[model samples]
Target: MMLTIALPTGRVFSDAVEMIAGAGLPCDGLASPGRKLVIEAGEFRYILAKPSDVPLYVSYGTADLAFAGGDVLLESAMPVVELLDTGAGRCSVVVAGPRSQAERFRGHASELMGLKVATKYPRIADGHFSARGVQVDIIHLHGSIELAPKLGLSDCILDIVQTGSTLRANSLEVLEHVCDVSLRLVASRKSTALRWKEVQSVMNKISSHVKEKRP
Candidate 1:
């Protein structure tokens, strides 16, 4: 039986491929897939997709297993089994704004009600603010989230930050840290139930490698 795995195709693609190859899976052309979206390696078939789309592929059974960021998984809210934390794509989901707005957020947070918050992860942003009993308008943008505050499109932004360099470069500062994110292994329900043995075998190998690499 063949196991179809979905690999995110962006910053963490190389890391995912390295982890799979380290787990003894063939990764001949994964590092430089170029235009090829699919690659077959013996019993394992790989599907390269956007990081945000991996969860959808696994949820719809297009791929049995996948690696996705915890933030993506949270925003997607797809019904898939989270198997393990691959410890890849480490970052933080944060709420940030310009220095002036940061001052208001810190000193008079209540007065900033209905402040516009821009982000790509609307679901995650909404949940975070809602949980905090704060109500703000969520402006969903596909890209260029940093520009929102500069253009006055939003007073703040709830997005992912890896090194704090982007925020610094944009003259923005983190007002709150929402959550830390990392790549996670997830599996479709159908695959987990029907291909239990195969899924378990692959999971065990990857899990072993994860443990070995952990410090």
Candidate 2:
């Protein structure tokens, strides 16, 4: 059976290319294709989409399998099956702000009610604060989340920080660690039922490689 897979096209892209090749599913076309979104390797069909959109492709059954971040999966709440944790692109979703307001958030997040927060993950941010019995005015921003508190657009921000350098450059400090994010292998239920053995074979191959890479 021909298996369709969706992958994001950024940080996880190169790593995925390498991982898939190591797993005996060499996508030579994907590795070398220029200006092409779709690449086919024998019975495997691969589509490159934005990281956030990969889950959507899998959820809609447009792609049989997908590699997505736990952060995006939580924010989007797509109902696709999270089959395995790949552990690539490890990072944390965090609440941050300029050092000026550091003391305030450090005490009690809920006390700062109506806090102005900026984030790309509104759902995640809302859920985090709501659980603490706090309400916030969430400012939705696609990028440069570190600048929100710098420019007075918000008191704090919720964003994924792979390294603290960006926050330091922006004079922000992490107030709380929301959750750790990593790539995970996901499969559509239709794909699981229709091509169970094929999917298992690929998953098994990759799973073994993942175990080898981890300490």
TM-score of each: 0.96, 0.96
Question: Model 1: which residue pairs collide?
Answer: none
Q: What's the C-alpha lDDT at position 132 in model 2?
A: 89
Residue 66, candidate 2: alpha-carbon lDDT:
85
Task: Tell me how candidate 1 scores on lDDT.
Answer: 0.90
Model 1: per-residue Cα lDDT over 102-124, one tens digit each: 66767655766798999999999
Report the error of model 1 at residue 66, Å.
0.4
Q: Which stretches of candidate 1 lie over 4 Å from their true place?
A: 107-109
Given candidate 1, what's the lDDT at residue 49? 90
Candidate 2 stretches with Cα past 4 Å from truth are none
lDDT of 2 by residue, 1-215 (tens): 67999988888887788779888896868887688999989889999999889889998989999888899899989889888989898899999887777787768766679999999999999999999889999999999888788788999999999989999898888988899989899999888888889889889999998888889
**Candidate 1 residue-wise lDDT at 209:** 97
